[model samples]
Target: MNILRRAAHAVLDLEKARCEKTVKLFRKLGLYRRILESTGTEPKIAAEIEAQMLSIMEEGILDQHTLCSRFVRGELAFVEFVQQWKVWYAEYCSWCDRVALDAFRQAA
Candidate 1:
């Protein structure tokens, strides 16, 4: 029973770490700003996005995933969203590469 409890705690910790990682990802992507700008023409959608963002900020991973999925299905122009997503992806990859190089250098 003790071992099982420890394992459960480990799992929870991992989930928390993943949530923090995802939150950082979205923050770096300026998700809130993008949602506001993209949904400007649709006040309802904009409000929904803002609500989700607030929930995610206060909650975590599950809300973040929900928000992202909702945005994908939202009324924002697909082409524009895709363009922005591509740019964000590229920047994220570059940042990852830099971090990896830094880690490698530190190890050496």
Candidate 2:
């Protein structure tokens, strides 16, 4: 395969591993339980949290789409894309952290 394709595959693998790690962390922390438990009496709170989560998730996807589009269009070099992706991923992780904190607070 070409170098670009190989790089893409390598990045994909890294992202997959990151995702798996995040899932495992969530499970270990009972993040899902905290979020779901709040739904029993406060549907509105649950709905709001769910909406926030979905919006953050969608924003990350859109950011990634834009990044890929720019790279494919030659607007950004591979090195620049990688750097921007790392920044984006850090922001995404912070968003996840906020979600986890909110979940636990709501459950409490």
Q: For candidate 1, what is the TM-score? A: 0.40
Q: Worst ten-residue run, lDDT, model 1?
A: 63-72
At residue 14, candidate 1 shows an lDDT of 76
Runs in model 2 lying further than 4 Å from the true structure: 1-44
Residues 1-108, candidate 2, lDDT per residue (tens digit)?
367865875676577567556655765565644766555735556555655665576567557766876775577998999999899899899988898688658766
lDDT (10s digit) by residue, model 1, range 1-108: 657645655665576677777767766675764665574424444444444454435454453343344344453466766766677566655655564455335434
Each prediction's total of clashing residue pairs, residues at least 3 apart in sequence or on different chains, is 0, 0
Candidates' TM-scores? 0.40, 0.57
Stretches of candidate 1 exceeding 4 Å from the true structure: 41-108
